[model samples]
Target chain A: MTNMNPSDKALVPFVSVDNMMKLVHHIGVEPMLRGLADYIEADFRRWELFDKTPRVASHSAEGVIELMPTSDGEVYGFKYVNGHPKNMKEGLQTVTAFGLLADVSNGYPVLLSEMTVLTALRTAATSAMVAKYLAPKGATTMAMIGNGAQSEFQSLAMKAICGVDSVRLYDVDPEATAKAALNLAGWGMNVVSCKTAEESMEGAQIITSCTADKQYATILTDNMIGAGVHINAIGGDCPGKTELHKDILARSDVFVEYPPQTRIEGEIQQMPQDFPVTEMWEVINGTAKGRTSNQQITLFDSVGFAIEDFSALRFVRDHIQNTEFFMDLDLLADPDEPRDLFGMLQRATQ
Target chain B: MTNMNPSDKALVPFVSVDNMMKLVHHIGVEPMLRGLADYIEADFRRWELFDKTPRVASHSAEGVIELMPTSDGEVYGFKYVNGHPKNMKEGLQTVTAFGLLADVSNGYPVLLSEMTVLTALRTAATSAMVAKYLAPKGATTMAMIGNGAQSEFQSLAMKAICGVDSVRLYDVDPEATAKAALNLAGWGMNVVSCKTAEESMEGAQIITSCTADKQYATILTDNMIGAGVHINAIGGDCPGKTELHKDILARSDVFVEYPPQTRIEGEIQQMPQDFPVTEMWEVINGTAKGRTSNQQITLFDSVGFAIEDFSALRFVRDHIQNTEFFMDLDLLADPDEPRDLFGMLQRATQ
Candidate 1:
């Protein structure tokens, strides 16, 4: 690591979307997800050092666009992400994102990255990180509810990080379930495509709900959950969106990534305002309990947070340092004479 | 322009920093500022239609980074900006920014522009717009305190929008004053470099403080002001940064953008919790009073609202549509099948 010298020629490495895809391809997906999970867990253990806030969102009739920003004194990062559920009908991804990492000392963007793929990786990595603590030891089976764009990453991350040996998947569209099953076929895990949510949860140690409908829909009921099962609730991530029944939330030992934000966007939104829940960071730090008994049920209400992206960026930055996968962007204007901003503009014009 | 058809291929126009500077050069600074002033005033008059919020800020030890987001339902916009006052000492611009405008229906970015240059222009335009409403009629003389990078833009904007023909400028660094004067030499306005703030304000109708220091330095005192003067306080935008003394604010009719944000970042921070200030939109909308008389001191305590940037993005988008000074950026991913995000990765990997 470089010493904290203020005057050192600071290096800000950026990976564009195309180049980032190349980097992922070079390293392979499973290894990248495992590495990202490790970084996320390590950062979560030191969560007190970060300045965090709920993402600021602007909602329109069609969808919502949000800015999720966070800083750790030395480096500041933010992602501009949009979620339009109906975008796929127009040949667009349901979500698109871009982000910037800046040097805190100068407030200059050192890295500008396409985060559409990175968000998928980071979100899955966060799920596995939470499951690493809450899920039963040597958990071998996972039930994936809703096989959409996020399904493949979630399946791979769970297999790679949590040692899941098989995944039972279900989606409203059988074609989606078939697509997920086909993707996971060569990954050395048993992929079981189920017809219903109840059938998917059979003998599963971890149940992941990542459906994309924008309303509160019950994908998992309390009766469907068995004891000692860890529920990775992922899709109920907005104000009006929910997945699990309130009974399931009330019965399980609920955990979340930032209590204030989770209260607004997580599955726990259906719970009472004064409902009790532990922050996932506390579990990662070992200051709070995860599962004390083999018979206890655990639920991790995972709404992606900025700190997870911060960790993912840190991971990508470190791994790509010795490689040429990063690109130098003309995002910040630097003048030879500090006061001559207009001089830089003048030179650029010429 | 495309008849607002949902299925039509809408043109996505962009202006890079270089292209924006060329546009400014081509259109002339006075006319560009005048056009921007018109856009800002029109947007401000319809403020209730906007989805407004206090900019989300991520503060670090060296400086602060902010995400300013706003929407008018049909279009969504946000600006990513950072301010590090000490950056100039390291040959970097103190503020660097970029912004995006998107279609609310699909959450697709319709325009992406470098906002560092546009921010300076829009900020000046906003100041001039507020001064047009709050300043005395036939205001021909102005005092510019802290003549730094933004001074020329302010001078040109005021000359075009408020008919200010002469400006008295002062900076702690004489070199900055010389630079400002040099940049404004042939701009058809008279520039006088003054030795101090007190000397600069003599016989001036508007007093603008755009200092760079990050502390409450009291650049303007109550004793330094004359009757009927309009103050366009530009700097001191973050917490712990202020330019006007409390006594000056106590006597002047202070106008702000958003009250909660202004209370924390604007010169109003120097006053009590219950201090009264008018939202500038109210005055622009004619719902509240502006300057009551020629003798009433008026102050526009601008902390730079998100709405102004929203207006600027709209202006840039429109102008780019009418011109050809932009490069198409593949910022979003288009998948043949929305559920096949992994397929795009798979194809890219191949």
Candidate 2:
């Protein structure tokens, strides 16, 4: 009666942070980012089939913990993420995440993977995918104004997915900018370190701001922006946190992942309740126009939605098959007789 | 520059199902159940300090998957559980679950454990703890209806926590009754396998009905209950599933875990909007009465709540401290410099 070994149904494929890094290098970072962008794009093309809700969040004085859940009928997925702005001072990542994918039929988790790296990858891929629809034609350079943890991922994603050949990096902390520049040195793209946000935007057709302040900070002022460039404003993600001035929102045609969520956590949170925005999925499916004119400023106010994480986990679940990148985790209990859970426990005394 | 090993901060302790059984056997099951009951009672005493919300559930044609989350300011916890009633026919556990406990201050997961077995333990402990307050004095015999997965745990908990010495088991399926009686054979108690529900209730002071049908079920009717008896009805957890008849609820003094949740998922869900019920926490904290007289029928409408799971995970987190019942999984990404996540990933190329 003593069953010491777990059966196949009891084990879930788990991709740890170490194995995730190995998988990333095994597939090459740029190509992997491109592949993730494709997956995000595919999900967006059929976004109407997904079960979408604003992520459930628990806020504290120090930080916020959130659960983002979504499903595409056949498979269900959810991500556990936390953001503590002060964690950087204590030598910890300001954001950490993990996610799971489960079968809808049996409600058993099939894959569990660390998403700290995957979140960074998926976030950048999402921005680049939206840029492919909204950026100015032949855009070759981008102004990266954060230079924090997500800076390099955003840079490489744009270069790989959007054909951006050059990147100008800037941050309030010079060391952060130096670190990002050093990391992107051999990524086959021309990297430039700039002293000021205005200097970073020079000769760039795309301006991506992703700073790390919990409060509302004006990283991009209205007067500093010019026409005919795409603005990817991702830094203003939480309430009381906005990167672009309200006047800039008034001047650009904004595109968002999900309006209900973006209204609360994106730059549009500063706008009126009736503020107009286009959903990116509509643009991907050709139901709505994207970048109608090169002279019109296209702003992608990305707060990161559940569907993106679902797509990322879906990609991991599919990619880890027949590979040594994942280990079997005994996460579920499987008894010979479903109703005899106690009998199994009793036999475990052996 | 390549770092081959994860840092101490990156690893999180994970308890698999096998480890959970080992932990349970390391400390005897009865002692662990009593320990969990104490932890749950202590949490109930401070019920006002918790941040509570109804579970977030995603329903499907086959079953339902839910995330139950709660935080008590310093520590946060959530459980992912699925209830697929049809899974029994497919030789799968009807309910499977896993849970995590995290530090609210830093938002880092501290412990991850398989909860299929722990949930059974906690649910039974909760029932018996409530019985300690509401059952008639010197209650020694219990009628155990629905001898399924939770039957053995319930019987032991009633014995360990409430001094119940005899258990009369009855199920529609005779095989289920035989299996439960077989499992409880070694325990120091009088176990009687009854052919009918009426025979199981002979001289019993406590009647626990935990049938697993997804629709409205009537395992206990109004006439089946007698004066001065404690009714623990636990299987009516989902929106449309209930175990006890509504007439029984109207006749008894009903008590519940959390009223808002119980009204939708407990036996009281069959009653009207204004039906009055007492909260069990009030009874535990001395704000309300439990069993006032020998002739009054007391019913514990158990739908299960997030706080119970939090307490259970808390107990696991405390008990597995120095034991080898857990393994550290590299679940989080710990960069030496928080802002250099890309730099850390680049160094992993070694």
Q: Report how far off residue B318 is in candidate 1 (Å).
A: 1.4
DockQ of 1: 0.42
Return the lDDT, model 2, position A235: 90
Cand. 1 TM to true fold: 0.93
Residue-wise lDDT of candidate 2 within B1-350, one digit each (tens)? 56568898899999999999999999999999999999999999999999999999889999988999999999999999999999999999999999999989989999999999999999999999999999999999999999999999999999999999999999999999999999999899899999999999999999999999899878887788889999998888989999888888888999999999999988888898789999999999999988999999999999889999999999999999999999999999998999988888899986
lDDT score at residue B61, model 1, on the 0-100 scale: 76
Model 1 chain A poorest ten-residue lDDT run: A2-11
List candidate 2 stretches off by more than 4 Å.
none
Query: Which DockQ-derived CAPRI band holds candidate 1?
Result: acceptable
Which pairs clash (backbone N, Cα, C closer than 3 Å) in model 1?
none
Instruction: Give the per-residue lDDT of model 1 (tens digit) for B1-350.
Output: 21212222223355666577777777777788999989889998889899988888777778888888888889999998889898887677788888889888887788878788888889999999999999998899999998877888888899999999999999999999998888788778989999999999999999999999988788988889978999999997889999988898988999998899999999988888899999999998889999999899999999999889999888888887657678665455555677877766666755
